[model samples]
Each structure stands twice: as C-alpha cells, then as structure tokens.
Target: MASEEVVDLEHQNHNFHFENGPAAAIFSKATLPVTLKFKDVIYKIKIEKPGKFVKAAGKSEERTILKGISGVVSPGEILAMLGPSGSGKTTLLTALGGRLGGRLAGSVSYNGRPFSNAMKRNTGFVTQDDVLYPHLTVTETLVYTALLRLPRVLSKAEKTAHAEAVIAQLGLTRCRNSIIGGPLLRGISGGERKRVSIGQEMLINPSLLFLDEPTSGLDSTTAQRIVSTLWELANGARTVVMTIHQPSSRLFYMFHKVLLLSDGNPLYFGKGSAAVDYFSSVGFSPAVAMNPADLLLDLANGVSTGENGEDQAAVKQTLVAAYKTHLSEIVESELTDCSAEPPVAGDDRTLSRWSNTWVNQFSVLFRRGIKERKHESFAGIKVAQVLIVAIVAGLLWWQSSTSHLQDQVGLMFFYSAFWGFYPLFQAIFTFPQERLMLEKERASGMYRLSSYFMALTVGDLPMEMVLPTMFYTITYWMAGLKPTAGHFFWGLLGLLYGVLCAQGLGLAIGAAVMNLKSATVFASVIMLTFQLASGFFVQNVPIFIRWIKYISISQYTFKILVAAQYKVGETYPCGGGGGEVCLVEDFPAIKPVGLRGVSTAIGAMAVMIVGYRLIAYLALTRVGALKK
Candidate 1:
C-alpha cells in the first residue's frame, strides 16, 4: 500500500501549483505569448453523440473523453499530436477548429489573445474527407474557387498565377487538368483529392492550419510520403498542427514536436527523439519491450492482458517520475523569468464587420449556385417528360368531347400545375446528396444564404422557363386552347409562376428536414394539399374545405389559366345554364383587363414565393445540414 501511494504521487506530478518561485518561472516561460497559445489547458469532455435528446440522456452519466489536454504551437512550429483510437484526439482537434460547443474551461488564445470568431477566419481546417468539386478538373476547380472566393483580393492574372503556384507546389500539375473523378466518375485519385483539399485551404493562406487524420487510410509508404510532403509545406513561418494515428518510424522523424495522449491524459509532449528516453527515466525499462512506440502506447492505455495492476502501476509511476524530473530540471536551470506583474487581459471579444459584409458574402454564394447549376443536366428527363405531355395532349385534342373551351381550360390548368412541380421533384433528391458539401462550404464562409437563394432563383431560369414553355406550347396548340400571342403569354406566365412557387416550397421542405424520407413525405403532403385545394376537376366542395382554395397558389394559378384560355360565353357548361355559367361579359381576363384579379393572383404568388424562401433561409442558417 505504501509503494502504491508512491506510484500515485509519481503519476500526479503533472498536477502541480506555481507556489515555488522556480516552478513559477519555468511555467511562465513554458507558454510564450504567440499567435496561438494553450497554457496548461485542460479539456474535459463527456462522451456522448451530439444532439438534444442524447445529450440529455447522458447528461449525468457522461464520461470524460479529453482531460488535461494542454499544448502550444506558435507561429513557426508544427505540433504533431499522436494518440491511440478513442483517446479523444479528434474531440480536441475539433475544439480548436471551433466545430463543437461544450462547457469549455480551457483557454485557447490566438495571437496571444483569447479565442474569438475572427480567429476562426484565420484558421483553415482540413477534415478526413476532402471536400472538392468533383465535376471540375483540378485546375478548373481551383480557378473557379479562386474566382468566387478571391474575387476582389487579386487581379485576373494574379488569381490564375496564384492558383497555378498552389497547384504546382502541391505536386498537382501533372493532374491539374485531369477530371476529379469520384463515386460517379467525377475524376481524381484519393491522394490527389487530398492535396486539392489542402490547396483549397492554402488559397486563402490562413495564418494557422489544422488537420485531422491527415495521414490516415493511406499505405505506410503513401502515408510516409504524405507526411513528408506536409513537412515540406510547413517549412515557412506558418503554424501547422495535425492529429496522427500510429505513424511509421520513417514518418516519426518528420514531426518537429509530438503530443502523446492516452486515456484523456498527456503522457508526453516535447521533442520527438526524447520520447522513449523520457519514459525510461520515469522507471519504465525499454529492455522489457524493444519497441518504444508500443511501450508508450501500452503505458498510455493503462490496461494490458499480460500486465497486472503492479506492472501497469510501475509504468504509470515511471511516466510521472520522468515528467517531474524534467520539470524540476527546467525550473532549477532558471532558463527565463517573468516580470512580477499580473498578465494583461486578452482581446477575445469578437468584432463583426457589419457594413458590406453581406454584399461580399452574397456574391460568393451567387457564384457557387451558378457553377453548381451549370454542371447539372436538364436535357434528358425534362425533354422526355415534355414530349410525353405533348403526345397525350394531342391525343386528347382529337377526341370528341363537349364544351371545347372548358376542356381547353382544364387541360391548361393540368399542364401548368404539372410543369410547376417537375423542378421540385428533381431537386428533392439532389439537394440531400450534396448536403455534406453544402455544410463544408457554408462553414468555411464560402457564401451567404440570401445570395445562394437569389442565385438559385436566377440560375434555374433556363430549365425553369424551357421545360414549362415546351409543355405549354405543345398543350396550347395541340389542345386548341386559343393559340393567340396574348393567350400564350398569360398562359406561360401562370405556368412559370406555379413552377417557381413549387421550387421555393420544395427547397424550404428539403432544407428543413434532415432525412431524405422525411423531406419526401413532407413534400408529398404539401403537393397533395395544394393539388386538392386547386379548383381544377371539381369547383365547390364544402365551405371549410373550399376556404383552403383561397390560400392555394395552384388554385389562383388555375384561375389565371382559365381566364387566359376561354373568353366569357366562348364555351358554356354541359348543362348550358347552371349557376356556374358565365353571366358577366366583363369577366376576369388573364390579360390585364382592369388589372385587379391579375394583380391579386400575382400578389398571392409573390407572397408564397417570399414566404417559402424565408422558411428555407431560416432552415439553412439554423438547422444547417446536420443530422440529429
């Protein structure tokens, strides 16, 4: 028991106060004021998935994932943190990256200042998954990103030259023009893609760079090469910090400083070569285990099959003893002394550049939306659907039916309504597929929500107008629905209006729901409600149900279509003189007339469009693309 107490004391060396003058002096110099500083920073985390319900469930039972995680990487030093799986390494990396929120107690200072949102802009984070535009070639992708992101920052020649230089430095020139093939053949190799991601971050030349698992999943040789490449990249006056798993012996020498973590504890953090020796000095004998890496790993985990409590206790004791011995020597040497004064308060408060911030943000978003829509195809399925509609309308036009004018009006409403929803269905599945990329861009400040919204509205014009025009042109002529220029113009306007409204509603629903199934269900319900409320096949249902018609944009759209197709008394009811029969010659004309009903219909559609857009923007800014 006495020996066990000694072992506990040895392990508790890291838990010390600055009561001693020498100790205070050593600690004062330990964390120098720099762009990035973490002073004896301890990050304790409760292990649980992120969300409201799960967070609540594990609120009391949460286990600490990261504990006493403290380190510093100044402006010119690259800190390579090494840790075993489940050591909360990723959590620590993410905390520094500003991706997670928690009851954080540690101080993460930037520029010798406490952390702030502006620091986020100055830091570039590269996750395991490299986010790139798969459709664009390497050069095209980088150039496009540069054009949008660095528009006012550089001139045309300078931008191109900068992108080329970045590409050349990253060894991507050989494959610069090659397509970045992906899951569906959007071309590039995994290594190339990874470098591209790095290049993307470098384009901004952020003051600090943070990467998670930069060498993961590659073969030993490939991993070594990648690590060497990164070492070369970090040669300048730039700070690069990355979390790596079990690195090969060859790659170990590439790191300038190493942070070794085990079971939420910092086992060793300093120069790489002294790692094994430091452990040995603590009472751990390397003779028992030839591999220093394996020994350090086992010592960190604190649990091994061949080792009992005493055996593990000795290892822990050795680590503590070595740390204390090192700390004592550093303090006794009196390398440096701090002034006898309180430290100044850091500038951690974030400052927002309110003026014209939206303008730049919107421009970036608009460009991204335009580029995304440009690469997408609208020829195949849309053309086929339009052809099918034309054929069916032609067949219906030839059939012997009563009230030609009424039939024409019904056909016009059906065609307009169908055309309006095609864009919605197409985007329903597509938006979810690109959700991850959307989040990546959004988080990186690539664009603003309003800008993307406007760009999407404008960029979709080609397909939006073409598809509806084809449907209306075919149906109007084939179904004999008054082929005058006036009729065609109003009919087309009503159809496009419905289509745009549907597009807005679909985007809103898609953005709101995390799961594809839930989004589809919501869209289906909305579509059904609107279609039913539309006064198409049946006019008067019941008062309560009929009231829904006033709110339905589709109903008003159909009203416009009806007025455009048939003049008053041009076609009577099948019963000839019912209450529904037209008695007023000055009927509502889809074409201006007195501009009252037309204005009302247009106004209703405008309100619907804006309302759905507002809902979509709120969903995007608040919910984002994160799953529960």
Candidate 2:
C-alpha cells in the first residue's frame, strides 16, 4: 500500500507542477534571498532533581540539548536534518529558527548578520501538529491569516487575492469552502489539512522557511509531494530547512545538504548525495540496494559496523572528525564570503510586528471566537443539557406559593451556584488548548495580548447570554416565580453577570497553569470555595471568615435574584398560620446586608469580571514569556 501511494504521488507530481501554479507566480515577484548561518551553537537547559529537598536555592543541574552544532543554509537550497530519535534534530532546527528559549552559546545570523525580530517576520516555521481552527473553511482560514499577517500596503482586495493564490498553489481548490474539521466534525482530509498549514505560512511569501517533521503522519507519496513542493519553493530563491525522519532514496537525494546528528553532536554535514562517498572514505559502505537515509540513521544510532572492524561508535567518531577536518572549513569559508556582501534594505522589517491596528486585531479575533464557539458550544448536546437541567430544577421547586418561601430561596440559590459552576468549568479548557498556537503567534509578534483578551471577553457575551436566558426563561415561568417583565429582566441580567464572572475566573485559572488537568482541578477548588461562602448553604456568620462572602460571585448573584423576586413592599404567608410574613423575616440570609438593590449586585459582579480578567491577561503574558 505504501509503495502504491508513493507511485501515485509521483504520478500526481508529474501532472501537477508546483512551479506552474499561481503560488509560483506570486513568488516570482521577488525579494532578496535569505541566508541563514549558525556557528558553534550550544543550547542547554536546567534539569531539576526530584525529591531533593536539600538542594541549594536557585540551583539545578544543566544538560545540553545541542552541543556546538554548526552549519549554513543558503537561499535556493534545502537543508534536511536527519538523525535517530532523541538526537536533537528538532532542537537544532528550532534553534536556527529562533524559536528555542534557554541558556545558549553561539551566534545565528540571517543574511550574514545577527538575527532580529524583523528577520523573523520574513521567516516561517511549521510545526508537526497543525494548529488551525477546525471550524474555519480553508479559504476563510487563509483569508484571516492574510489579513493579520500581510502588510498594510496591501488593500483588502489584494490580501484576498493573495490568499486565493496560496489556496490554488497548495492545490486546495476543491476543499476551499470546506471546514477544517477535527474529531467530532467531518471536514478536509489529513493531507489537505497539512497543505493548509503550509499555505498559511506561505501567505506572507517568507524568504526563509523552517519545518519540523512536515511530512509526518502521511503516506510515502503524500510526503514526496510535500517535499517536491518545498523544493519548488526553494527554487524560488527561498531558504528551506526541516528535520525529517527516514526518507526513501528518491526523497533523500532531493535535499541539497544533509546534516546527520548523533547524541546532539553532528556526525556529518555535507551534500546529500556526497554523504555516501564521505562515509565510504571513513570505512563505512552501504550494502547493495540500501537506502542512503536508512544507512545514515543506522550509522547515527550506532547500530552499524564499518569495514575496518570498528563498531558504530568508532565509525561515528571517525565521521565526525572527518567532517570537522573537511566540511567545517568549507562552511566557514562560505560564511566569510557571504559576510563580505552588503545586506539588503527594505520596509519588510516593520512587517515583523502586527500588520493591522489594535482594533483590527480585536475584530478579527472576535470573528474567530464566534466561528469557533458556533461549532464547539451551540451543539444539540449543550442546548439539551441546559434545558434538561433547567427542567429538573423547575420540577423540583414546582410552583410553590409564597407560603413555601424557603423552597423559593433554595431554587434561586441553586440557580446562582449552577450557572457559576457550569460556565467556569466549561471555560477552563479554552486557554490550555490554544496555548501552543498562541505561543507560536505571540512569538512571531502577531498581535498584542490585550487585543486577544478583549476580543475573547466581547465575543463570548452573546453565547453566554443565550444559555442562561434559555435557562431562566423556562424556569422563571414554570417554577411560578414573579411574572412581571421587570422582575424577569433583572433576574436574567443578574444571572448573566454571574456567568461572566465565572468565565473570567476560569480564564484566570487556565492562563495561570497552562495545563488542562491542572486548570480543571484548580477551577474546581475555587468553585467549591465560592459555593461554601455563597450564603446559600450556611447562614450563621463565623465573624472571622464572614468576609469571604464579599468575594463570592454566587453570593451576590443569589442576593440579586432574591431581591428581584421579592419586592421591598411584598408580603408572603408564613409560620403556617395564614399570617403575612415580611420579606426580611422570611429570608434572613440577606437581612444583615440589607438585600441591596439589583444595581449594587451588578456593580459587584462587574468588579469581579474586570479583576479576574486582568489577572488572566497578566498570567497569560507571564506564562507565555516563560514558556520555551
């Protein structure tokens, strides 16, 4: 099956020439080529010892991931890093792409000069997993990326044209209008999704492209086509660097240069085809019909023996020494020549930052939020859950007369607590799931953190309004609460505010921990704490902890709902004596605090929303910077 797939891919490549596509036309409008060079680059990270309580303050052992690896990749060439698992190929690629964060020694230059944020703007990096919105159509995804990434010089129409060109170039015309769906929803194929990922980076026509396992999870033919497309891209005077696993000989020979690594050290770095000859000189020869990439991996893994009767380790040592003596000199000489040349001047530097205004970013993110939520949140299951819960609660309370004022209070408190818990739990997954994508874009300087936060807060309002409104509408009339429109509206407003506060708290928890499981656990603890202090379950005040109620959104929401249902002048039959009972005596929970008006409750909720969201934003900013 794999062989057949490979043949089919070759046939497709014959029929579909990437260089003849609209993307080629787009790339033909040239900018100066990029040359990326890294010299003696060493990247190390700290390793914390577990269960070592006696360790000194601010101290930990350090382990190097990449040790003094050096190489140069010039425009119009493809440099592929090949090695065994745990060999640091991806780390080296990331380091060259300027994405790795840690203690580092050595220099990486672009166009014969040190790298800057401006240079990264003109560079593209594609990760193994495609981080795209599954709900957005292919065209819509590309269009949005173009809007956010393209320069202001390009008009809306021009950006749209560019997006269309990229779609055509990637051969995604058939699925152009199809959603990029995932596990639950059916949408584009895996190969098509990979192409869409590539197309996003291509929208900006980057001068240098870096990919980590771009062909992973694809059949041989699909992988070949991807590499072939990348080759065409390189032919357009763009530098291409990627880390790849085992490749067929046909695919292996396609790369202009190949760097073989073993244990974070370079074993060989030279022309891809010349690798065979270089190894042959080091007393290592491939058997007849053996794939060069396979042989290289075997050598790097210390699983192969050489003709000189030495084991794999000795062979690797010889190869590394040979490359240092032969290939390293060539790379250094080339870097010197390239450095003598002057740098290219252009306005491309400014494009490194956001291409759109703050308002524009907020608008784009707002639209994205709506589209994502429409797919993930408004499904039949979610609506059914809300309706079922509302129905159950209403049935349990069952239209009690004012005589059963205790039951009414219980129902209102349940309403407040449930809304708070449900929304908070649901929102905990939001930031953790998007952390990788957000980190990537943020590192690229795509948009401000504040813009994204505000967009999320505003975009969620409509959907947030929906579930609670549906819930309250069914329960309010069914449970036989106050029937006046004024009562219903105020109660609904109070519940909506409760949902906002809960969601804000969830965002803060999610942002602070950067892990779904941790955030969920943390949010649960917070919700439970709020519930205990909400004034619903416990009325007696332990003076020392009574202040907890001031910070409980559930408490305020309950107060507002109770006040809305029972007016100041209203009276209810109580004490089972057919005597009228005053509102204050009937519900003593809010009496001490005076059961304030709806506005006061709302003001408190507003404060919670702002405070929690501010914490969320700050947490996200700090975590994003701290993440490697």
**What's the lDDT for all of these models?**
0.62, 0.80
| Candidate 1, 58-164: lDDT as tens digits | 44545667665556565556778776788777777777766657666566656545445445445568888877766678997777665544424345555566577
RMSD of 2: 7.4
TM-score of candidate 2 against the unseen true structure: 0.92
TM-score of each: 0.78, 0.92
> Which regions in candidate 1 have their CA more than 4 angstroms from the true location?
1-35, 40-63, 148-153, 280-364, 377-410, 427-435, 572-598, 624-628
lDDT, model 1, position 264: 64
lDDT of 2 by residue, 275-370 (tens): 988887876777666889998998898765445455767766777787787778887776677644345333342322455679888888899779
Candidate 1 local lDDT, residue 571: 36
Q: How far does residue 97 in candidate 1 sit from its true spot (Å)?
A: 2.9
Candidate 2 regions exceeding 4 Å error are 1-24, 52-59, 307-312, 339-344, 347-352, 580-582, 589-593, 597-599, 625-628
Candidate 2 residue-wise lDDT at 50: 56
Clashing pairs in 2: none
